[model samples]
Each structure stands twice: as structure tokens, then as C-alpha cells.
Target: MKITFLGTGTSQGVPVIACPCRVCKSDSAKDKRLRSSVLVQLKKSNIVIDAGPDFRYQMLREDVKLLDAILITHSHKDHIAGLDDVRSYNYLQKRPMDIYASVRDQETIKQEFSYAFREYLYPGVPVINLHNIQQGIRINGADIEVLPVLHMKMEVYGYKIGDFAYITDANFIPAETMAKLMDCKVIVLNALRKEPHVSHYNLEEAVRVLEFLRPEKAYLTHISHLMGFHEEVEKELPGFIRLAYDGLELDIPNSWSE
Candidate 1:
């Protein structure tokens, strides 16, 4: 299986407006990040996690022509705003793509993409078949499961798609969720910055999760400019846990046994 990091920036994305930080102005392409999202491909089937505002740009950059499904973690705009861009795939396949999310998020989608849900609207608008998933639904043919997590006070979600698990926009993962993610070979978590925020898991908190979860490897995403230079913050992390940047690709096994 191969996974691609589409975007790694936090809600505001990297290079915060008007702030002339060195990392923001750096020439290295690694410093640039769009909103956090990922694409997973298993042979012919393709799955995308979160369709933030940069979804269009991410698709264009990767030249993606088809996708089997889209999994949403929450209703946050940065995570679901770009959902409309899936029309390109719908247009090409002449079919609606399967969309999986919690019931709460489904309501959010109805409000956010009311045009797409108009029933008898534009034939060209993207059409999605909603599949409301709760805590432990298997992903179609996959043995993997979804684990709901608490992002501080509000509830966001994390997905365990076999051996690879992704949890972004989360500050806390309760014991139950942690238990579900125990054996993951690769774990991706959000690390917004060095300093603690009210909602997000800062770099330190992410590190703590890495330590507590003890996955084979951990990758950090959903970053903010507050996290500082990619290389710099990465240097401080343990070898088992690395920071993820846009366009990063990794090949891993399916722990959930396909």
C-alpha cells in the first residue's frame, strides 16, 4: 500500500499571512504545506482522508483522475471544504463517489455542500453516496476500523485503516481509542505547534502520544507555522516519530489483513 501526504499545514496553512518568519520565507519546498490531508492507494482502489480547501490543488498537483472513496474526520472547514472538488472524479467515472463520515459530519456536509445535495440540480455537479460510519465500521472490503477520538472538548475522529492510522486535529485520544490503535505500524497525528493550544495537540503532546501509543512509526501532520521550520522541529523528535510534509509518500503493510 502507498500513502501520499497531500497537505501538512494546520487550518490556516503554512506561511501565515504577514508574518515574516524565516521558515516561512525559506527557499526549501519542504517548508511549504497546504491544509492537512492524505491520499491512500491500494492497487486499483484509492481512498482520500479529509478534503480540505487545498483538495483541488492537491488533486491537480498529483494528477489524480479517480478515487474510490473519501473519509472525513470531522466537519471543520479546513478538513471538509474541498469536498466539492471530487466532481472531477465523478465527471470522469460518471458515478457518485462513496463518502464516509459520522452522522454529525453528514449534517455538516449537507449544509456546506447544499448544492451537491439539491437532488435535481446540475448534472455536472459532483454526486456522493453518503455512508454514515460510526466508531467501528469496516472500510468496505478492508478489515480496518474507525476509532472515534476526542479533540479536547469537541469530538473529532481518527481512522485506523489497517496497520496505518491517521488522527489529525486532535488534542486527546482517550484510552479506548488508544487501545484500538495499539498495533498500528504507522500512526499519523496532528501537531499544531510548540506551544499548547486550546484545541490542537502541540508538538509536545504529539510526542507524548507517540510515546504512549508506541506504534512502529509515527508521523506528524496538521501543522501550523507556529511549529517552526520542518527540519528544525523534526530534529528534536525521536527517530521512530517523524514529521510529515506535503507530497511525502510511504509504502506500508495492511495490519487489518485486507
Candidate 2:
């Protein structure tokens, strides 16, 4: 399986509009980030996680010709805003896009894209099939485990597929969710910045969680300009953990034996 980091920045993204911070102005490509999202490719399926506002460009940049499903983490705009663009795939594939989300999130989607659900639909509105997340849900033969964590008081889902796990926009991870992630070989988590955040883990807190989980390799995502330049911040992290960047890809074996 292969995983591509579609975008690794926070809600506002790196180089936040009109800001003059050094990390924002850095020349390195790693410093330029879009809102956090990822594409997971399996032998027979392509899945995307969290199609934020940058989803269209992220898909186009990756030249993704086929998409099987989308798993939403939460209803936050940065995570769901670009869902309307799925109409492109609806047109090409001649089928409604399958979207998996919690019951609460499904309501948000209905409200945000009300036209799609109207009795009389527009010619080009995105056609979506909303599926409520449930236990033992499989997509194209891949087993997905949902890990629920806390983004402050709100619940956000992190997904575990094969031996890889991804969690973002979370500040507190419940013990049950931590248990689910304990066996993952590679884990991705959000680290908003260097300081404390009420709703997201800061760099130091993120490191602590990773250390406890002790994955073979870990990545930090949903970064902010305050995280400092990628190169500089990288030097401070444990060798096994690195900050994720847009367009980065990873190949994972079905098992560690590979």
C-alpha cells in the first residue's frame, strides 16, 4: 500500500495569508503546506482522508484519476469544504462518490451541500452517497478501524488501516484509541505548533504521545508557521519522527516482515 500526504498544514495552512513569519517566507518547498489530508492507495482501491478546501488542487496535483471513497474525520470546514468538488469524479465515474462519516458529520454534509440532497437536483451538483461509520466496515477489501479522540470537547476520528494510523485535529486521545494505535507500524498525528493549544497537540505534547505509542516510525502533520522552518524543526525531533509535507509519499508493507 502507498500513502501520500496531500496537505500537511493546519486549518489556515502554512504561509497564512499576508503573514511575514520566517517559516511562511522560507524558500524551502517543505515550508509551503496546504490543509492536512492524505491519499491511501491499495491494490484495487484509492481512498482519501479529509478532503479539505485544498482537495481539488491536491487531487489535480497528484493527478488522481480514480477515487473510490472518502473518510471524513470531522465536520470542520478545513476538512470538508472541498467536498463539493467531488462532482468531477461523479461525472467521470458515472457514480455517486461514497463518503463515510459519523452520523453527526453526515448532517453537516447534508446542510453544507443541501442542493445535492434536494428532490430536484441541479445538473452538476456533486452526487454523494453518505454512509454512517460502523464497526467492521471494509472498503474494497481493506479493514478500517476507527479511533476516536478529542479535539477539545468535540470528537474526531482517527483511522487505522493495515499497520498505518492517521490522527489529526486532536488534543486528547482516549485510552481505547491509544490501544488501537499501539500496533501500528507507522503513525501520523497532528502537532499544531511549538506552544500549547487548547484543541490541538503542540510539538512537545505530540512528541510525548508518540513516545508513549512507540511506533516504528511516526509523522507530524497539521503544522503551523509557528513550528519554525521544517529543516530547523526536523533537527529537533527524534530521528524516527519527522514532520510531514505536502506530496510526500510512503510505501508500507502488509506486515513488518516485508
Candidate 3:
């Protein structure tokens, strides 16, 4: 399976509007980030995790022609705002996009995009089928396991597919979720900055969790301009862990050879 970091920045993204931070002004391309999101390409299906405000551009930049589903982590606007653009896929695929989210999040989606849920929908509206996430839910042949964690007080979901796991917009990961992540070969976690954050993990905390999970490889995402330049921050992490940037891609075997 292949994984792509569609966007790695926090809600406002890198180069935050009207901010003259050094990290944002850096010349490196890695410093330019969009909102947090990822694309997972499996043997028979392609799925996207989160559809933030940058969704359209991310999809166009990647030239994604086929998409099977979208897995939402929570109801936060940064995670679900660009869902309206799924209409492009609906037009091309000639079917309703299948979206998986928690029951509470589904309600929020309906509220946010009430036009799509109307009995008599207007033309050209995004067509989507909402599925409440549950055990044994599979997209095509890929089995997805939901990892529930906490974004401050709100419940958020991380996901495990095969030997790859992804978690973002989280500060507290429950013990049960940690157990589910133990065997993952590759893991992605959020690290907003060097300082402590109330709803997101800081660099130190993210490193500690990755160290405990001990995945063969770990990546930090959902970064902020405050995290410092990508090249420098990366050097501070363990060799097994790296900071993920927009457009970063990874290929993982279905199972470890060992």
C-alpha cells in the first residue's frame, strides 16, 4: 500500500495569514504546507483521510483520478470544510462518495452541508453516502480499524490499515488505542510545535509516544509555523522518525518480511 501526505500543517496551515515568522518565510518548499490530510492508496481502492480547506488543490496536485472513500477523524472544520468539493469526484465517478465518520460527526456534516442532505437537492451538489464507522468495515478489500483518541475533550478517531497507522489532531491517545497501534510497521502522529498545546501534541510528546509504540518508521504531521524549519526540526528526531511534509509519500509492504 502507498501513503501520501496530502497536507501536513495545522488548521491555519503554514505561513499563517499575515504572520511574518521565519519558518513561514523560509525558502524551502517543505515550509509551504496546507491543512492536514492524507491519501492512502491500496491495491483495489484509494482513500483520503480528512478533507480540509485545501482538498481541491491537493487532489488536483496529486492528479487523483479515482477515490473510493473518505475517513473523517472528527467534526472540526479544518478536517471537514472542503468536503463540499467531493462533488467533482461524484461527477467523474458517477456515484455518491462514501464517507465514514462517527455518528456525532455525521450529524455535524449534515448540519454543515445541509444542502446536500435535502430531500430535493439542487443540481451540482456534492453527492455523498454517510456510513457510521463500525467494526469490520472494509473499503473494497482493505480492512480498516478505528483508533479512538482524544483531541482535548472531543473524541477523535485515528485509523489502522494493515501495518500502517495514522493519527492527527490529537493530544491524548487512550491506552486501548495505544494497544491497537503496537504492531503497526509505520505510524503517523501529529506534532503541532515545540511547546505544549491543549488539543495537539507538541514535538516532545509526539516523540515520546512514537518511542513507546516503536514502529519501524514514524512520521510527524499537522505541524505549525511555530515548529521551526522542516530541515532543522527533522534533525532533532530519532532516525526512525521524520517530519512529514506536503506531498511526502511512502510505500509499505502488506506484511513485514521478518
Give the per-residue lDDT of model 1 (tens digit) for 3-23: 999999998888766778987
Please report the TM-score between candidate 2 and the true structure: 0.98
Residue 43 in model 2: lDDT: 85
TM-score of each: 0.95, 0.98, 0.98
> Least accurate stretch of 10 residues (summed lDDT) in model 3?
249-258
The whole-model C-alpha lDDT of candidate 1 against the native structure comes to 0.86
Q: Give per-residue CA lDDT, model 3, range 1-258, as digits (tens).
A: 899999999999998998988987889999999999999988888999999999999999999999999999998999999999999999999999999999999999999999999999999999999998866468886789999999999999999999999999999999989999999999999999999999999999999999999999999999999999999998988999999999999999986222
Model 1 clash tally, residue pairs: 1
Structure candidate 1, residue pairs in collision: 163-255
Clash list (residue pairs), candidate 2: none
* Candidate 2: 10-residue stretch with minimal lDDT: 249-258
- In model 3, how large is the Cα lDDT of residue 235? 91
Q: How much lDDT does each candidate structure score? A: 0.86, 0.94, 0.94
TM-score of 3: 0.98
Error of 2 at 214 (Å): 0.8
Positional deviation of 5 in candidate 3, in angstroms?
0.6
lDDT of 1 at 94: 80
